[model samples]
Target: MDLPSDTPAASRTPRPARVAVVTGSDSGIGRATAVRLASQGMDIGITWHTDEEGAHRTAEEVRAHGRRAALARTDLSRLPDAAGVVEDLARELGRIDVLVNNAGTGTATPFVDMEYETVREVIDVDLIGPFLCGQVAARRMIRQGDGGCIVNVTSVHEHQPRVGAAPYCAAKGGLGLLTQVMALELAEHGIRVNAVAPGEIATPMTGQEDEDVRRTSRPGVPLGRPGDAREVAAVIAFLASEESSYVTGASWAVDGGMLRMGPQAGSHLESDAWRRP
Candidate 1:
């Protein structure tokens, strides 16, 4: 593949913002997605909560692709910042054509032991943040009187329950419904809403080494490997493009095959021998 710095520029007409806004884009799937979009000739509005350096690196990659990249320092845990964040990007970029709600957080904890603060933060970031951004983007698109696309990055847990991830699951589940609602509400205005539910991607959020995350994590996947950031990004790009004019309110899972098994442990049971009558 062409590294951002090595990418050849393709010419295109200038559109407002001419860009895509990717939250949590300083690293991981967000970073990869931002760079991939830039390579396709879109400018980028990148958001980061903590990784300024990583954000700059992504901006550099965007520049390497001969596209503009603007970085914003944002913490989605604060509910009030969501709309403001979208507004700020709009002001800086001139327009918001594509909005990718990729910023989120989760923890591995039992629901009973979960603290309210953690629950609040996770919900605010994973669900409310996207809601706010989507609301703002929809209004803007309506005002512009042109169609736009919204892609929310969710997870497999949005469909299936997971152990030790109550708030995360709740937030993503809420987001899943929100995507549908937005699609319905915005469809008449020429806006499309969709989501990408990534299974296991080797990113910083997973807190696993890239190589190890790719290896050990894939045994359950029919494809036999963890998803790369680029794989998920491709889905987002397609949703953002005119190519997906008929697609909306759909969550595309990027996880290998982890969700296909109802109970991972049960897959090992193999019956009969343990049931002594």
Candidate 2:
């Protein structure tokens, strides 16, 4: 982490307005995170794989907050140059201070029935993509000689598995460990890394597309409903902010207590008359 000779002392000051690159920010949790980081006064770099229009909409929200916004198209699964978008955004925004690796895809096919290509695709998107993006961001941060942050948007599956989502579960679990390793390596350079694992968020990914979480109901979730994308974004924003300066290599759960229901669920069942094996 060598500083340039001309770097100003003030540039090293705490809490300076910074820049962030958020991948797959066209909609859902990515969109909410871009907007929330904007509201916090950071210029944003937005990317999309398929939703160009939604990316523009997210940029509009960022500009509405009076911060600069840059947009690009990134397919993390195909990394011709994993850092290309980060370089472009850094050139446009002048520096990269935060990187949120939020772009990912999943499949619900059972492990036995899953196609090899589908499993590869999920791993490429969920694990490999973030790994490359984080590496690029870290290199940039090290070159800039200033601390930075990286937040990987994992899922409850990072800690627990689902019935038919073997690839998704494996990739997320891999990413959770990757986050810790990145944190360990980058801490010496003042770079922080962490993860946010959300459960049943009301987003397009969960088939809730734009639905309000407050209006939704879920009996299985201890909190009584799915979470909002914004709710998850709030935790991400914290991890990206100076407020979490001391936090690194940690995975914060924003799952509305859904992760706690597994054991309690069986115990709470009313038809438990037989203990015979």
lDDT of all predictions, in order shown? 0.84, 0.89
What candidate 2 gets wrong by more than 4 Å, as runs, is: 1-16, 80-83, 266-277
Residue 232 displacement (Å), model 1: 0.6
- lDDT, candidate 1, 85-184, per-residue tens: 7778877887888999999898877678889999999999999989988888888878988678899999998998777788899999999999999999
User: Candidate 2 deviates by what RMSD?
Assistant: 4.9
Relative to the true structure, candidate 1 has a C-alpha RMSD (angstroms) of 6.7
Q: Give candidate 1 regions above 4 Å deviation.
A: 1-17, 209-217, 263-265, 269-277
Error of 2 at 273 (Å): 20
Q: How close is candidate 2 to the true structure, as a TM-score?
A: 0.90
The lDDT, on a scale of 0 to 1, for candidate 2 is: 0.89
- Candidate 1 lDDT at 192 equals 93
What clash count goes with each model? Answer: 1, 0
Q: Model 2, range 11-41, lDDT digits (tens) per residue?
A: 8556456999999999999999999999999
**Against the hidden reference, what TM-scores do the models get?**
0.88, 0.90
Give the best candidate by lDDT. 2
